[model samples]
Target: MGSLEEDELVRMVRDFIESESPSPTNSSSSNCLALSHRTQYLILQDVLTGETSSEAKVLKHVLKHMKGRRDTKRSTSLRNWLVKNLKIDGLRASLCQTSWSTSLGCPAGEYEFIEVINEGENGRTERLIVDIDFRSQFELARPTQYYREMIDSVPVIFVGNEDRLCKIISLLCTAAKQSLKQKGLHVPPWRTTSYMQSKWLSGSRKELENPRNDYTGSAEIGNWVPPMVKPRKMDLPSASSALSCQFSNMSLNCCNV
Candidate 1:
């Protein structure tokens, strides 16, 4: 992620904390200090932006806040907020909508997102299950091997690990790219270059290809793919040419979830 992106993420964290946490001046002992909330926001910013090498600060922050709470309540709450507030919901919703890249258009492996809720000694724990059927979606020559065996073999990541969830998404997106590459197919040129006209280009293909961007902008600021606009007749050829140049120069850096 670029510096611009990191700042945007930090600002988002601030907004959430400010909105949810009680004001310190209210004098309610049960209410956490606003300063403490700010500190935690900074810690999360560092963790997400890779400014901090050690997650010890984050661990300490969680432990301190969750002292009497049972079974990692702070972690669970944070994880839930991330899942619900972030663009994860939007991405899942996209599955219900029609896309130009579906079946006849050389779609990637089909994925089903399932949520598992379980009762545990601690409380209720939730896990996200991603079932990708590469064979059917990509029309593979050997269906059973990868779909029935390999893709299913990848472990379902629990909801708490945002980083792990990102990896899982990146893997899925990579599979999509690979399928497109193998078939010698490409997404429409206009879809790829529309971001540039909106002054939203991040100068990296990683930003362009991030699946999170396929949803709303806040999902990933630097990588957010802008909503498309109708271009004028004269701008059509230039935009098309620019998209072609980008595709030709694109690197295999598909991990920006």
Candidate 2:
């Protein structure tokens, strides 16, 4: 999207958020939701560009190894593989499941994503949210070319701090609502900002131990080896599956973010 169009989209999102915010002072909330065009550009840049940050390094390593891996077709499988391999590389990685109760017309739902905890200097710790298929989360049904271009800029794999992730979620959810409205479609509750925020911001953490046995693996990137472990059964229902089952009549695409 061009700079002028990008600015207009941001303004539209900002206005939508402020209108929905319960607080009388919309400016305060608007300020919080305000993500400049440059900031949005940098989100993709941070993921694509080489960076020395620990999180960036880990993201790069994971992406490199994940390339051409046929076993990671599903989001859950991809996250599990990443956690196991990241732990082998001496990083504290785990699977996080976030679920929220029905509220404000949104249905109850659960989501799964990967989380990596970084223990920094002086005992400081940072938690990063890693969504392997991030861009798919914001995809709308029959989106306009303008909206499609905006979403295309989102990185496929998103690794960032909570604040950064929240901002992105807010921006995308608002844009999704606008796009749907333009198409004369009802914005499903699952696509709302509150629901999207619940995906990453709220959940329980499940840490899987590295498998004792090691298996050799090869890919175009290099000889990437991930431990061989039995596929553990998770009783929790993924948000996509749950929503699809619940809203079978609704002609909406289920996004497993």
Candidate 3:
């Protein structure tokens, strides 16, 4: 599909929003207004880049309504359409492809898709593997291992559907976490690239507010106290005895002199 002009894309998205979800009397013109500013910007960016196709639109709509266990015929139809038509092995090259060193996939938004290729039998048979790679949200590795582990366990799923896409993402995360755990490395909640340490905040505040969940104790100095020492007491003669001894000594000294 040809890329759309900014204004035309906005109008089409607004129309789609109005048709899909109409707001109440007191609400805004459409439910799209309720989306985050970043999301709105991404929508515009995708549209302008010609990435906002019917499949993408349907996935976005389904994701927006995934709060509860709610299901609808429209969503089911979209999912069915994707499962029936989309081929997992040979997808559009623009979407995902493996290269000499790097494998480029979908845009790295909340998550990204990756295509891993493995050659077997002297490159006679090629294995086209698809896996989810958390981008800015989290980190993932060993795409080939994850694909092999997941392919036999889970049934074939059309990732064009938001629900299935999310499932695939979560599955990959779980596998990655398990792998890390097996290696005695704890997987953090947020990606390592994200800024968790800041100089502005105190050490204690930084640890507590860290999303990694690895921080448990405060980084602030503890209320430590030094060990106390008791003074040693020395016994002294009485004042009267000391006076008598001094007088005796004086008398002895005079006689000696």
User: For every model shown, what is its TM-score relative to the native structure?
Assistant: 0.21, 0.63, 0.20
List the lowest-lDDT window of 10 residues for candidate 1.
196-205
Question: Lowest summed lDDT over 10 consecutive residues: which window, candidate 2?
Answer: 20-29
Tens digits of per-residue lDDT for model 1, 1-257: 79997797567555533443222112111222232333333433333343122223323333342334333222322333333432332422111111132232333221222222223346744332221221233233433332233244332221222233332232323343344445566633222212111111111211111233222223232463689999876645678888887876664344442
Q: In model 2, what lDDT does residue 174 have?
A: 59
> Which one is best on lDDT?
2
Q: Which one wins by lDDT: 2 or 3?
A: 2
Residue ranges of candidate 3 with Cα displaced over 4 Å:
1-148, 151-159, 191-257
lDDT of 2 by residue, 96-210 (tens): 7877778768688888888888886669898887788778888876997656877888877878776556556655665666678889999888887777777777553455444
lDDT of 1: 0.32
Candidate 3 residue pairs in backbone clash: none
lDDT of 3 by residue, 1-257 (tens): 24566566667555533343111112222344354333344443333233224344433433332323223222322332222222232332112321121112212222113222333445543322222212222334433353334433432322132222332333334444455666667656432111111111112221111122222122222455789989889889999999999999999999999
Arranged by TM-score, best first? 2, 1, 3
The best candidate in terms of TM-score? 2
In terms of lDDT, the poorest run of 10 residues in model 3 is 193-202
Residue 197 CA displacement from its true place in model 3, Å: 23
